[model samples]
Target: MIPLVDLQTQYKSIQPAIDAAALRVLASGEYLGGPDVSAFEQGFAEYCNVGHAIAVNSGSSALHLSLLGAKVGPGDEVITSPFGFVATTAAICATGARPVFVDIDPLTFNLDPAGLADAITPKTKAIMPVHLYGLMADMDPIMSIARQANIAVIEDACQAHGALYKGKRAGSIGLSGSFSFNPGKNLSAVGRGGMVVTNDDEQAQFLRRLRDWGQDGRYNHVHQGFGYCMDTMQAAILNVKLRHLEHWTELRRAHARRLTCQLKNSAVTTPPEPHCCRHVYQVYAVRSASRDLLRAAIATRGVDSGVHYPRPVHLQQAYAGLGYMEGDFPEAERAAAEMLSLPISPELTDSQIDYIAAAVWSDAWRPRAATANLGVKSTRDLARPAQEQSEQAA
Candidate 1:
């Protein structure tokens, strides 16, 4: 079966290098705050074209640290889109700041800058725009709005490792950017890891102290900080993975282009990559009115699919106290009901992509009742040759 992400296949491809990195870290007896972590922080900072990168324990910690560094605290409000992982809101809440929800642009699935200005208030401390599904948010207007309001703009760039917006790297646009090295991400570690990138020297210094028990030095407590240091082994593994991220990103983009072309005439709406951006296709999601039915249909044909978020953060049970209702953010709710993430692993072959596209196209147009009797067509019958498909897509 075609899984959404095949980490096993990815691991097998570079087992020796990964094993060696991990073993070297193990042999050194440095599991935390070592040369490995320092090297990775430097490598990641250079990769994002930023001045500093502070490695953290998780993406959530990265966001939280950045918020605290921005001086966002209780009674402050952080403006962001409601259509994202709960970690974004959680990070804001951890900083004792309230998260203000804004509707997203239906096409780009990023925060709509039009609503951004209105969302600002006396209490608005920072604007955290999430770069969802490997696509960078429209930053020009967001940055302009933030500048006019004189508030910091932090990027929740956990899913957007190499995405580019108007030629600027995802994590390098705002005051600071947070990234995740969760195994499923484009630049993943073997386990959970994260980083915060910034050009602000003061902010970087603050974050470095904050992630390590608020210490200015060993046993010298400067401020009350949490334990958010990245494991040295995880950093070493990530360093190895970082070397291959650009190539993998290109492969993902190529696969996404072909998938979008193949599904051009299908019932579902394909994801769009605007001319001003370069999408890494971390999750090649499509919108379908009958999302649940379509998912089931594709499953019968050996294809698998997923929903990035079946529920918006504002509508989640944990955030019910936020006092939001079903229709508060129409676009976010609509996307929650329709979005379906398909497999876009770099390891995927052209034939696999064609088969996946054919399955989706064929079932997307069929009736729900007909799906039970799914006269499944062989890949040979349903899929066109790669060259023919490319030309047709052209």
Candidate 2:
């Protein structure tokens, strides 16, 4: 079966290097806050053209810490798109700040800057624009608005490691950027990991302290903080993986081009890579009105698909107190119903890409009556591994 992300195949391709990195960390007996973590942070900062990178245990922690570092707290509101992973909003809530929902651009699936100005109130402390599906948000306008409002912009670059917006890398474009190293991400570690990148010295230093129990020195706590340090082993694995990231990103881009070429003229709408942006295609999501049916049909042909988020955060039961109704963010709501991610792992063969495209194109246009009983499994069951499926359910 063609899985949405073939992490097993990717791991096998670089097994020797991965094993050596893990062993080296094991031999050193420095499992946390070691040289490996420092080295990886430096390497990643250089890679993103940023001045500092503070490693963390997960993407969620990266976001939470970044928000706190930016001094976002109670009585503040963080503006962001509702059409993204819930972590984006959760991070804001974790900072004791309100998460204000903005609709997304129909094409880019990123935050719409046009709606941004209206959302900013005196309570707005920061604007966190998520780079949804590896495409950087339209930052020029977003930055202008933020600057006018005198607010900080924190880029959610978790899915956009190598993405570029006007020649600037994803993590370098905002006041600060957060990234995830989940095993399925474009530049992943063997396990959960994350980073916060920025050029601001003060913010960088604050993040460094915050991730390690707010320590100025050993046993000397300077600020209230949480235990969010990145494991040395994961950092070492990421160090090895970082060397191959650019190449893998190119491969993903090429695969995206192939799929777009094959499906451009079809009924479904392909993801757009704007002229000012270089999308990394971490998730090659396409849009169709009948997404559930199309996904089920594709699965029947041995191709799995996924929905980045099946529901908008504002409408979720967890955020019911936010008081946002179903039609509050129409663009976001529409995207949640229509966007479907196909298999686009760098390890996929050309033939596999062709097969996936064929499956999508064929099923996308099939008669509704013929597709009624395509043995539809939920996207979660088809796209994710059993372990991930169980974890998500939990």
Candidate 3:
């Protein structure tokens, strides 16, 4: 079976360096916010081309701190895309701010910059767009709207490790951005971790305090803050991974390009990389009329797959208070139904990809017929039985 992400391969490749770093940290006896973490902060900041980076326990904590550092609180609203992980919205709500769900551009699966104004209210204080699936959103329009409205823009770059828009790094384009280093991510650590990158020196300073119980010095509790500090262990592991990130990202891109070539004529609609942005392809998600059937078939063929989001955030059980219902954001709703992520991880092999391609060409999956209301591109032309299409329509 082809694994979704082969962390074991990465782990073994750098086991010696990683083991040594972990051992050195163990010998130091300074676990939290030690020299290793500070060194990692410097390295990651230089990697992102940002002036500062504040490490945290998880991506959610990074988002939480970025909000507090920017002074987001109750009665304020932050506009972000609904087609993303719940953490992106959960972080905003944690800061006592309301989350305003915006639609996504069908092409990039990122927040639609054109839809920003319609979702904005006087209470809107920020636009926190996730670089979903490791693809950078259209920064030009989002930045344009933000500057006109004077709203702070915080990028949720948890998935996009090194994705670029217009040749600028993803996390550095906005006021600041949050990153995750979970084992599944492109630039992953052994377990869990996150980082916040920004050019604002004041916010950077405050965020460091925010993650450490708001104290300027040891045992001097200056203000009430949560214990969300990043430790030396995860940093040590990540620093080792950081050295090989570019090479791994390139490999992932190569895998994605090869898979894209094979899937170009398959039943699934392969997502294309936009010229202006380098899509690192953290997920090579395809759209299809038979998303369920194709996914089940793929899984049975000894390959793993997943849905980046099975449902949009606004219509989620937790967000009913936001007063949204079905059909509010048609593009996002359409995407939720047909989006399928194939095995596009760093460790997928050529033969396994060929098997996936062959399986997709078999009888288990079939395309849908022409529906006037169909919004998912390339689903209308596949050959599906009329009866199956009717059942799905109902």
Index of the highest-TM-score prediction = 1
What range of 10 consecutive residues in model 3 has the weakest lDDT sum?
A: 372-381
Q: What is the Cα-based TM-score of model 3?
A: 0.92
Per-residue lDDT for 216-334 in model 3, tens only?
Answer: 89878776788988888999888888999888888778777667666665667776566567778788788875688888887787877888788999899999998999998877887
The alpha-carbon RMSD values of the candidates against the true structure, listed in the order shown, are 6.3, 8.3, 6.8
lDDT of 1 by residue, 130-229 (tens): 9999998889999999999999999999999999987999989899999999988999987899999999999999999999999998999989999999
TM for every model, in the order presented, reads 0.93, 0.92, 0.92
- The parts of candidate 3 lying over 4 Å away from their true place are 369-394
Q: What is the lDDT ranking, best to worst?
A: 1, 2, 3
Q: Give the winner by lDDT.
A: 1
Q: Judged by lDDT relative to the true structure, which candidate is superior, 1 or 3?
A: 1
Instruction: Spell out the clash pairs found in candidate 1.
Output: none
- C-alpha lDDT values of all predictions: 0.89, 0.87, 0.83
Question: Per-residue lDDT for 1-394 in model 2, tens only?
Answer: 8999988888899999999988888888889887888999999999999999999999999999889988999999999999888999999998889999888877778888888989999999999999988999988888999999999999999999989988999979788999999978999987899999999999999889889999999989999989999999999999989999999998998888777877756757777766667889989998877888888888889998899889999999999998899999987897888888999999998899889888977844473443221332211112335564344223
Q: Over the full model, what C-alpha lDDT does candidate 1 score relative to the true structure?
A: 0.89
Clashes of 2: 0
**Candidate 2 residue-wise lDDT at 33:** 83
Candidate 2 lDDT for residue 279: 84
